[model samples]
Target: MTFDHNPRILFLYGSLRDRSYSRLLAEEAARIIAAFGAEVRFFDPHELPIYGSVPDTHPKVQELRELSIWSEGQVWSSPELHGQISAVMKNQIDWIPLSLGAVRPTQGRTLAVMQVSGGSQSFNAVNTLRILGRWMRMFTIPNQSSVAKAYEQFHDDGTMKDSSYHDRVIDVMEELYKFTILLRGQADELCDRYSERKQKGVQESMSDIGRMVNNVNLSQM
Candidate 1:
């Protein structure tokens, strides 16, 4: 399918540290995607309330949902902590519901996963994110990035230092942009499922029965 507008990409980073390398990496990816002619936005997890702690009407929750709905693709960057993806990352993902009534916010979107490691590079975080992306029904790209010794890879100003790691981020973002372009206008047909269609048909039938029942009751009254 073709798109008449620039692709919309949302970036989510895991880390609350003052010098969070995950956030820095996401920022670098954002710059790359923007240069690729995509419109990008970032969700600051610090402003978000813990999942299940607040109602959906909460400002941060609403903001996140709105962004997800607006985005055609996403980038998830998390730090590897204790040989796994950080809880901060999990919490952010948790806040995004798998479905909102009949609308699936994340389904059919393109996803790119990245991770930052304090020590030697590891794919733990990205691997976990890929699983989550699959669970969310996203079309995750084959390319990913895992930055080793993340502290040494980013400057004090949060800009990524010149290195192969930086190059990988650009590659990931480029792939994401291309995927977003390919998937944007086709998401509905691409995500369509027979099961969901059957379920919806059942629901509509039940609704029609309910209305009929109510009308009969009113006539009897």
Candidate 2:
């Protein structure tokens, strides 16, 4: 099936520092995806409270959930800290539940993982992101970006400098766009499961019984 609207993509980055390379990388990916005719948005983690620190009704939490539901694809850029994805990145993912009421926010959505490292190259952050994506039931693209010495990868303007790492980011975004276009149109079919169908059937039965009971009480009155 064909889609008329542009593919919406959301970006999440780790680190809230004055000059965050992870954010820069995510912005760069957003630009590339936008150029490829995809709509892109970023979730600023600055004012976002830690997971469970505030109720889900908090403004930032609501914003994050709304964005997740709005996007057909997502890119997660995290800084490798202590040989793992930063807490900031994990917290953002934590806020986005696997299911929001009747809606599965991330299920069947395309995902691309990227990471920026302070020292030598490491895939720890991206690997961890891939696991999280799977847990969220998202279809993570095979291509990923891991930039080492991230400080030197971007210029003073926060734009990525022309290099192999930059090229990989572009490749990842392209792959993500393709995957989203291919999958978003078929998400319902792809995510359909017998377990959920059975649960829905049970709920319908319960509702029908409740209505019948209410009608009987009204007749007695």
Candidate 3:
């Protein structure tokens, strides 16, 4: 299937530091995907409040949610903190509810996870991101990147150096782009769940009953 427009992909990085490796890595991936003809955007987590600390109507929260809805796919890059995905990453995901009224912002969207570490290479952050992706009902791509000693992998200019880790990031982005192109058209059908359909039917029936009761009350009056 061909897309009439470039596949839109949203990037979320975990960190607020001046030289956050996760952000750099995400930027690198964004560049790669952009070169492959995918439209990309990033949500700056600098002012995003902790989940539930503020109303969903908060500007930053609204921005993030809007980006999630606009995206055909997403990339989550986090720094491994204490051998797990950083809270910064989790907070961003938390802001985007699984269901927003009748629209499910993330369902069936393709996801790619990546992580950076100060020490040895570790998959902890990426692993946790994959779990979160599944929980959000997204299609997590098979390829992922975990940069060991991330500080060394990138140049002073925020561009990644030529290395195996860089190669893997390129691979992951390519796969994500391909998956999004292949699935964006069919995502809704692919993610259709019997349980949700049944629930929706029940809700509609209840609404009908309520309307009927209101009509009868009006007639009696």
* Candidate 3: C-alpha lDDT: 0.94
Deviation of model 1 at 168, angstroms: 0.8
Give lDDT per model, in order. Answer: 0.90, 0.93, 0.94
- Candidate 2: give its CA RMSD in angstroms: 9.6
lDDT of 3 by residue, 117-166 (tens): 99999998888999999999999999999999998999999999999999
The top-ranked prediction according to lDDT is: 3
Number of residue pairs clashing in candidate 3, backbone atoms closer than 3 angstroms, sequence gap of 3 or more or interchain: 0
TM-score of each: 0.88, 0.89, 0.90
Ranking by lDDT: 3, 2, 1
- lDDT per residue (tens digit) for residues 1-221 in model 1: 44578899999999999889999999999998999898999998887888898888999888888899888899999999998998888988887888998788899999999999989979989999999999999999999999999989988888999999998989999999888887767888988775776677756655765688777856556
Predicted candidate 2 versus true structure: per-residue lDDT over 67-180, tens digit per residue = 999999999999999999999999999999988778988998999999999999999999999999999999999999999999998889999999999999999999999999
Q: Point out the worst 10-residue segment of candidate 2 by lDDT.
A: 201-210
**Cα deviation of 101, candidate 2, in Å:** 1.2
Where does candidate 1 stray beyond 4 Å?
202-221
Angstrom error at residue 57, model 1: 1.6
For candidate 3, give the lDDT of residue 85: 89
